[model samples]
Target chain A: MSMTMTAIVLGMTVVTYIPRMLPFVLLKGKELPSFWQSILQNVPYATLGALIFPSILTFHEDPSFALIGAAAAFLIAFTGANIIITVLGSIGILTVLSLFL
Target chain B: METTAAAQSEFKDGLAAGTGIAIGYVPAAITYGLLAKSAGLTFIETMSLSIFVFAGAAQYIALSLITIGTGIFEIVLTTFILNIRHFLMSAALSEKTEEEPIWKKAAYSFGVTDETFSVAAMKSGSIHSSFMAGLILISYSSWVLGSGLGYVAGNAMPPVVQESMGIALYAMFIGLLVPSLKTSLKAVLLAATAAILNCIFTYSGALSSGWAIIISTLIASISVEMAGRAREKGGIE
Candidate 1:
């Protein structure tokens, strides 16, 4: 890599590393308050919801196909089908739908 | 000798898993590479970003922001906001790593991607440094390899193929969500509320699709907690 690219890469690495490392350093060997801990427990659900919901619903120009695809994938996944199968099912459905619409 | 052996076994396990994750991530990372290249990044620049930035969504957002000539400060600020969840993930994993030395703990923490967190949390028995390290190494290597492939394969793919690859992310998300849906009503409610709020935000033009995720997730999570507390007091499920 060029010097400029190398420098940028290193800079980004440090910045990214700081965030990941901070909590481990600061929160280790400490007892968070119970209420805060409870709140923390919910963080994953919240973060995942935030990350997935918007993109699945309205981010696309026509979200219906994606929603249908998601619903199909969800149902299949819920039925204990493998993830690859579920995704393929959704993509298959979308491809078929595109043919019709 | 047994301890050393176990550690060796654990590191091998990590390397194996990292190899698997790298394989899974290749397609998506390739897509990112193509997008980055098409967005005017040189191959070196694109690969460097992947190696350093490492956060998938944030890297994509940064590329888009850069392409549109968003100010450096704004791009940095957005990257920071998007990555706020890493703080929570790191904290959760930190509690689970009580036995490791500080340096090992720090090294392992750097590899805490979303998939790694779920895998690590679900791991049985007391946390072993080697096992956790293996898990992280697997995930980190997968991410880097995927990014590299994406860079190399840039723009050679058909548009249809590119669009289809996005299904992988949605597929992965659904995989995560489906299991959780059965675990709790709070999970369902949280997901539904976020979906609704996301639609509202998108329609209102209040936030970009990415930022809407951060907003809706925060609101839905807080609401789920408050509602859960109220229900528990009232003996509601």
Candidate 2:
């Protein structure tokens, strides 16, 4: 590869992998304090939540259809459908809605 | 007798669980590939980004930076900031899985994306490395393969169709978040807080998008957790 491409790839790899690898190296077999653990436990839900919400409203140019997509996802997910089904169902609803609305 | 069999079966169960993630990843990764192609990345460039970086949002940002002729230092810095959340994910996961050699831990940690982390976190009890490997294996491969496929398929698609596919990304996030929301009121409040905080940060132009996400996640979760603890102490619902 060209030097620039190689540099970009290596840089990307390092930055991406470090966050993933650091905690494993530092905290292996160790239990965090309960307060910290409680914070850690809520990380996923909070992060995923931050990614969605108002952001979903702006993801599509048509905010109305995006709402339909979000609602579809919420309905399927509320039913406790598997992740694949919930996502696919939402996309399917939006694709159909995109056609009509 | 049951121990070996259970371990073996758990690996299969992990693979089964990962199928949903794999399916979700394909469309998003495909969109990434298509976008990368439009941004002037060759097939190898797009594929290598997916293979090496392996983070969807980071790669998309990379494409944007590349298009703008951003310097390597800035691009790398942005991705680092964006992916810093993985540290929290890995830290949380460290508590749930059995101890293994740091090398194996390193290997599995590489696959810890937002989606896979949620899958692993939602599983009951201590997670087996074998199960993690199985889950990571399928989800990782689907991402790689989907990127390649999307790069190959980039040319034939119409512009409008490509634009519509963007919604699939948000839909996937909703799918991941909504299930958790159903189980707890705290989760719902946590999500709303994070979302509102993120929106304010971005709208106010007070912080970069990466910083916004990291700060919102930290503040919303830690505060909500403390509030929950306070409520419990006071014997309030």
Candidate 3:
């Protein structure tokens, strides 16, 4: 890698590392107020939900098949499937849909 | 010796648990690689990205930024913004993790991608360093390896299949979200509200996807939390 590229890569690594490490490193053995804790706790679910939409629709050029994949995943997951089966089942559904399209 | 054995077993279980995430990562990382190849990144450039950065969405954003001839500073800033949510994830996980040295915490924290954080957050007990190591090893290697393979495979994969791979990660999100939604009304509301807000921010061109996620998550979480408090007071009244 060029020195420039190496610097960019290292820069990226440092920036990403700070966010992931600072909180974990600094917050140990400290108790957050319950209100803030609840907010933090809800963050994972909220983030997951936010991540799924809009992007899911844009997953393909045409979203109809993508919606099918999403639906299939929701149904499977609602039935208590693990992440792997849910992903594979939806992929399987999309593959069939793609075949027809 | 006994402690080493226990840590080994924990690590083994973590590896087993992270397998699902590793599978979900394959297609996305490969897609990133294929995109990187077309954008004119060399194999080393591409692998350096996956190896050093390790955040999928941020890396993709970086690739696009690089492709457009954006400066390194801008690209780095964009990555930092895109991945800012890791702060919350790390904070939440800190509560779950067994207290360890700062160095140990920093080491495993580096691997806390969105999916891994979700997995670790949802698990019932304290997170050990060895368990985190095992979980991250499988997921990280799979992502880096997939990107390399995609760069190598390069346009050989069918178009339909290439696009279909996009659905896998979203499907993983649905799979993760549904059970949480079912168990807690707050979770359902939180998820739905955040999704709606994200869609609004995205289509309206009001916010970047990264900002949209962070804002929507904070808004939905706070609103749901307040609503829960209100309901409890009403029940008492």
Candidate 4:
């Protein structure tokens, strides 16, 4: 890897680690305000939504192909299967689809 | 001698509890490896990410951003924002764990992913460092080793299958998102709002993907909170 790329990885490690570590170091029994708590709680779902959409459509040349695979995933996920199953199950569907295509 | 037996039992319980989380991480970590490969990351670079960062969503975001040539600064900043929830989880965990010296908290705190946090947080009583070591050991090995397995295994795959690995990440994201969506109207609103904002930012060519995601998440989360406040003021919540 180039120096810049390595730097990015190192930087990422630091940034990711700080949030996971800082609170335990700094906070004992104190609590942040509920407003901040509320925002933090919602951030993951919000980020996941942004992460999934439009990009999911753009993954395949045929948007429908991506949508179909995504739909299978959604169906399995709604059934409350875990993350691994949802991913592997959809990949299975797409592999079968790939064979036909 | 007695403490040794108790700690051993706690560790064993942690290992058992972490087993399901370990199993769950495998496919996602494998997919992360494959995607990192296709994104032109070197194997070392890819594994460095899994080993060091170890946060699933942030590493995936890093891959996508790297492909788009985002700067190190932007990537780091995006990671900080995306992972801000760790603050909350770590705070919750600090209270749950038995008091320890600074070094041990630093060590185990580094292992607290969203998965590990929830499992540790929900245990019946005050937690031991030994118990966390077991939980993290099982889950951490699966994530790190599973990623390496994905990269090495990816090399032998047909090129077509390699290309198709892209969809799995999205599918996983959907899997992650929809459960929360099912549980709450706020989750649904937050996701929809963020998706719409991200689509606009991306499709209009107004922002890079890194900035787009950060802005969209902030706006959507704030908006959801505002709507929630409005409802409360109106006596609807």
* iRMSD for every model: 3.1, 1.9, 1.2, 4.6
List model 2 lDDT by residue over B1-237, tens digit each. Answer: 225876788788889878877877776788888898898888888899988889988998999998999999988998999898888888888888776678888988999988788788778788887888889989999999999888888456554555555665566677667766777898888888999999899889998777787899899989999998998989964
Tens-digit per-residue lDDT, B45-93, candidate 4: 9899998899998898889999999988998998887787677567656
* TM-score of every candidate: 0.79, 0.90, 0.95, 0.67
- Evaluate all candidate structures by whole-model CA lDDT and list the values in order: 0.68, 0.82, 0.86, 0.80
TM-score of chain B of 1: 0.75
lDDT of 3 at B152: 95
Stretches > 4 Å off in candidate 1: A1-8, A58-62, A82-101, B1-24, B69-71, B118-135, B155-161, B198-215, B235-237
- Across residues A1-101, which tens digit of lDDT does each residue of candidate 2 receive? 66777788899999999999999899976778999988888887788877775577886777887787788878888888877787677766766666675
Determine which window of 10 residues in candidate 4 chain B has minimal summed lDDT: B154-163
- Tens digits of lDDT, candidate 3, B1-237: 227888999899889778878988888888899999998888999999999899999988888888888898998899998888888778878888886787888899989998888778777688998989989999999999999998999577777776777787788778778887888888889889999999999999998877888899899989999999999999999
Q: Model 2 chain B, poorest ten-residue lDDT window?
A: B154-163
C-alpha RMSD over true interface residues, model 1: 3.1
Worst 10 residues of 3 chain B by lDDT: B154-163
Assign candidate 4 its CAPRI class.
medium
Ranking by lDDT: 3, 2, 4, 1
> What is the fnat of model 3 with respect to the true interface contacts?
0.86
Per-model root-mean-square deviation over C-alphas = 3.9, 2.8, 1.7, 5.5
DockQ of each two-chain model: 0.45, 0.70, 0.81, 0.53
